[model samples]
Target: MAEKTTSTVPKGQKSQFAVPYYEISYDKFFQFGVSVDCVVFGYHENRLKILLIKRGAAPFMGMWALPGDLVYPNENIDVAAQRILRDLTGIDNLFMEQTKVYGQVDRHPAGRVITTGYYSLIDIAKHDPHASAWADGVYWMDLNEVPKLAFDHSDILKDALQILQQRVRHQPVGFELLPEKFALADLQALYEAILNESYDKANFRKRILSMNLLISLKENQKDVPHRPARLYKFDKQRYDELIAKGFSFEL
Candidate 1:
């Protein structure tokens, strides 16, 4: 015999077949958000430094972390990184490069956010220290003394450092952290700082000068007791022309 199921309703209740109060869809299952993190590196006093900010918001409030924020819905990731840097450091025209994307499911506490990390090199003395509202409390910490950072920032920094080391060897990126005019020794020292090792001075100079990328300036280092070294400036016009002609700046 076939069993019959009966629907029941109370006297004061609405009908069982009334309109549904809610709806669900399978199409909304795989949504995620995006964000940008800036690994800001600064060179000063012969030490490599990174910019860190004390969080003023929740999910890591009061904790030291890399400067970052959620990306606006209509903005691109690189633009978001630049915006975050401008807001946090009041500095612009930075040499920024995309490093990596962090997408661990639990990487963020508030929700599932995939953050694209970008690294920038800035001359500490050239930038305005009071640009960001949070800049007052922000600080430049020695790279060796980086504290426990929020999220996987430590890993991000490690990767960025490796990229920086490689970039320094084959590119003219060190000039970005230096003054407009620099001595060969200063340029070599900057390279050594990034490489974390001593390089042969003669060989270094030979390689750097052989590229014919610098414009020798008539000025010399001043205010020093020892013999002054001649100053030189990077020739961007020549560099661009060489680069356009398939010239590689390899060490």
Candidate 2:
């Protein structure tokens, strides 16, 4: 018999170069990469808060662990926890649901190609979810006190925070739901119901009106079963101007 030919090989490894290769169907389109991160927010004592943790390891060691990792890849359940809240309001795009994705393979030399972060709202005074072992000292940092975090997280957090700050006003379509002029009592009830908590009525009014986003019309609620309350309406001109200049009607 004739000897078989060798296309290529190491000096002594005759068969090493002969391995067959097969082309799999549609294998090129499988570049799908998915990751989930979250911005967990809560409200307590009229101050907005978010959950954060100190990194106890490298890549961002001693810095904040950010909203794109640390609570993902291993958190396989309880994501349904937010669904209850979602269904309660029957609203979509409630909070950062894949609203933005950081997709750049080289984003992390560590290995992920694509990433996404979701945001959720909660009552801060209630639960305390623990962070990963690599994350130490999990704390509810006041939104106003959020320190510089690791990675591009600061930008992500800032954007998500802005959405909620603005959304709380327009969502539940509150401003539109109110009549042109409304009583302070009705307005306070609107906020309390939406926020799922009570606010000190006097303080709530003071803080909300202090923004100067509302106009006190020279009118009062008419034909109410109770004492007539003052009336006010959202100032379209003022609201538009402040929003253009980065104003937030945080409740």
Candidate 3:
């Protein structure tokens, strides 16, 4: 039998090889840039504080912005958020959750960029002061007295705050911001801080204690000049069990 040769060209084409019709230049290809912005919320000194950093580069130089940066080419969104948080705030393993995506074309002054905002709750005492000082500017601003932020950060903070308020009503996220062994008063104060309003102490205690989510430490508050209040800790195991049984905490 004779050997058969197959043409490498498409049907009806005269040439055995096809020539490239159009070329795509690397520079002309659309680039989809991504970034992660963290809305770090912490409750300290009876006030809610948010982490912010001063812009060190152009487009918003010297202006206050949320602690964030471009997502590294080799990093995932969540990892990028964690890395940014650690770099900006010096805190790790904090309670962080993805909140929303902001894709306004003009959100970034330097270029078109899409951002994923993450809300994190952390105990202020756990932050490392030295690491936080590495940024061009790092400060914990009182949530109530926040100044105008660079870019769309103000909007992002507002959205995160609203979500935090809603989550506190039904979830136990507040525990992450408060001290490990806290008092009923501490819990009430945390709620008040987030809601920006005061609540009746007696009523707040009655409601929260009724849920049985707190574990009495059988110890009193330490280092206070006045009479020490009873200390308590959140019962995660019990909370989880209750939540699994369709229990919800609503204040």
Candidate 4:
């Protein structure tokens, strides 16, 4: 029998033929598996930290790694990422964005595997993480103190951090890593921690205030050493309205 072909034609148009399935090769493509890695960043104790898992399986068993897993054959990659993150970290419903893809031929020893990296920021105090699935243990570590990771995860993490740093300068994403109501000093500290640099206090405060994204809560910090500072909250409603009117947020 001749190889099978498929076609679709519009009214009064000639049919266009698609190459026969048997004429194309899929064996090489089938050999590779797709996976996702999560780079979950949080701010605590005036430092930037990342969530990591202690692996329980081979190919780097007992080593520290970003929570990750292979995608099921029928699963959507984005859904797979969310599932793997929740399965390993016990934190769900947090927004995450794709950072990059790692596809070196030898990145995985067990087989040919490619992985996409995802990153998200969260308030460390809001949720507690427990290890599950292939993760024997899970905890937060200071970004500056991260250990050598399994696979190419170290590279994946570095790229994610760079993306986070760039994003904070152009968006309000860093606020996700802070408390809902925070002092201006706390906000500045969080930004410094992520960027690994200090900003001039006067200029930084002026620029941030001029953006009109923060609402003074008419509240002050309580139970703190030295003089208490004023507290503010991000005005998300105003931000949405401004965005609709073509306002650009930049640091």
User: Which candidate number would show the highest lDDT if scored against the true structure?
Assistant: 4
lDDT of 1 by residue, 114-190 (tens): 99989977777876544365533578888989999988888999999998777665556555677888889888888
Query: TM-scores of the models, in the given order?
Result: 0.79, 0.48, 0.79, 0.84
What's the CA error at residue 185 for candidate 4, in Å? 0.3
Considering summed lDDT, which 10 consecutive residues are worst modelled in model 3? 16-25
User: Which residues of candidate 1, in runs, are more than 4 Å off?
Assistant: 1-30, 93-95, 131-136, 241-251
How do the residues 145-244 of candidate 4 rate in per-residue lDDT, one tens digit apiece? 9999999999999999999888766566445666789988988888889889888888879887998889999889999987999999889876665545
lDDT of 3 by residue, 1-251 (tens): 43444334555655423552333345433476799899988778788898888877776878888888889888988988888878776777766898899998779877788999999766677675322533577788788888999889999999999997777666655555767898888788777887787888788888888888889998999898888999998898977766566444444
Query: Which prediction has the highest TM-score against the true structure?
Result: 4
Show pairs that collide, candidate 2: none
Ranking by TM-score: 4, 3, 1, 2
